[model samples]
Target chain A: MDFEDFYATSKDACLRAVMATVGSRQLAEETVAEAFARAWASWPKLSAHPAPRAWIVRTALNVHVSWWRRWRREVPAVEWTDPIQPPPDDDLPDPRLMAALRTLPPRQRQVIALRIFLDLDTETTARTLGIAPGTVTAHLARATAALRACLAPTTGQE
Target chain B: MTQDLHALVREEFQRVRLTDTLDDVTARGLRVRRRRRSGSVLSAVFALALASGVALSLPPGRAEPDSVRLAAWSVRTEPDGTLQIVIRDLADPDGLTAELKRAGVPALIEFKEVEAVTEPGRLAPHCADDGEVRSPLLLSVMVRPTGTDKRAWAIRPDAMPPGTSMHFVIFSVRDAAGKSYESVHMSLVDGDPVPCRSVS
Candidate 1:
């Protein structure tokens, strides 16, 4: 598809995937803008990539990992006390799951976000995050275990 | 337990609400391209202005050396569109925001020192004559506003020969939209009244 169409259709989806990875709306917004601007600058090169979505997602991820952004708040996990009124898109993860996801290491959080939120397979997730496929598996495994434990009801009811 | 975990994790994304914006991104993408063109044109103008400024200092008979000196903080626009503003003291410069307003830019510009650094050698000669600042004064030049939605760029105090502190002016832009964005444009100067050079 053309750049405008690609942007209209994929921008929000791409951002949500990144939001799940970065966990901060403002930072996510900035990252998305930077990536899209770069994409526009070199659309010819990027449009030809084998997996354009993967490239866009990877570009957003690269912005998150930038050294300057390293100075951003180091929250272990985000805490959401109230459920946001459902947006037009009814599909939102439970806050408990979001909190649990945030507690994971940033790398692990990114891996799980790509795998679960974007449904990227192992190789694609690995490519987007610039990690080895084996590393993706390890992170996924650990992240899955962590989420399971963290979200498990303490009373053993859930 | 593993099966249950997978189910719960997968469910989390099912109702995921996204917060990305397309309109703003689309607008910004276009602006980014235009800025590159403006930057190049401005560079050429700056070169021409610099060359002619030294050679054609004053017009023939009516020219006076007295006309050359200007107060620090006088706003001037380079051939390329960067606005050069001077910071003489701390608080808001009395007429700066107003002057900038007249330039078609809606801005509330002020100076807050993260750390104090003083350099007086660069002041405009006019300040010395008026005893406004003597011996050492900052440079001042004429600056004009070029457009709306212009990003506020800063000139950091340039490296001094000796005994001067080094600090950079940081211009953080908070547009009407209430979203703060930093332009790639930045300036580094040796002292006050230095050109707010465009580094982009």
Candidate 2:
């Protein structure tokens, strides 16, 4: 696909997953924005991959962990300074669910992001994470339980 | 439910900012635009070349040239048993030789520009006398010089008996600008040079 088509289809969807994993909108936007720059520079290679969305998400996730970005390389990116607040709307997710998700470890958050937001199955999630299937299931189970409990107590209030 | 989690995540993500994503995509799309343009141009050029090559290799107008060549070879045996070959316009002497050879007549052919007729009373041998000029196929003949190329030539068949061959053709072209009237004369008697004779 051309760059426009790929970006239009993938940008919002990937942004959501990255946002869920990083637990901060600013960082997620910055990470995905930079990841997309890198993807465009080498789109011919990335577009051929079986899961380009997974690849972009993984690259964004890796930047969050890669010491090189923190210490060495100034990877191509723009500083994201857009307003982060969502307008008040009933369609917004229950605050309790978002709060419950924030409490989980980063690995479990990644599993939820890939599995729930991105809709990858177990094997693809594991591959995206560079982890085994059992580990993905374990993290997914724990994160689900935590969210269930957090939602169970809340009755239409954050 | 799995659907619930998906819905919740998608909904919350609606909050994040997205300002210059379109500009970024536009920049990326520009990078590949050259590749597409160049590929189309190359295909167009290749198609043009292929079409021109096919058009160039086909034959030119055949009927006109063939008819003119046939008229150049119009001939009849004189009452004295000599052959009278009328060459009116420009004709390939080599082609005329082929026609004569096919008619069981062994002969030699030669072509010389009019400038070659310098010796007094010995001009380049062509049909100038009225009796020898039955069909003036051309009104004028002009042989223009391109470089230092020679205009005089001679063709003597190896098989013709130089002394006994009674039938031979000495067709000569003139030195005028347009519509050249050339002639070919053949003798019935043994002679080294077939003298240009009266056609009547």
**TM-score for each prediction?**
0.50, 0.44
lDDT of 2: 0.55
Residues B10-119, candidate 2, lDDT per residue (tens digit)? 66666554444668645644443543464586567668879888432212212123223224344343344333354433346556555555544454444433323334
DockQ (Cα-based) per candidate? 0.23, 0.03
Model 1: how far is B26 from its true place, Å?
A: 2.9
Tell me each candidate's RMSD, in Å, in order: 14.6, 36.2
Model 2 off-target regions past 4 Å?
A67-95, A155-158, B14-17, B25-200
- Rate residue A72 of model 1 by lDDT: 31
Predicted structure with the largest DockQ when compared to the true one: 1
Q: Which stretches of candidate 1 lie over 4 Å from their true place?
A: A26-30, A62-92, A154-158, B1-7, B17-24, B39-200
True contacts kept of each: 0.35, 0.07
Candidate 1 lDDT (Cα, 0 to 1): 0.51
Among all windows of 10 consecutive residues in model 1 chain B, the one with the lowest summed lDDT is: B124-133
lDDT of 1 at B45: 63
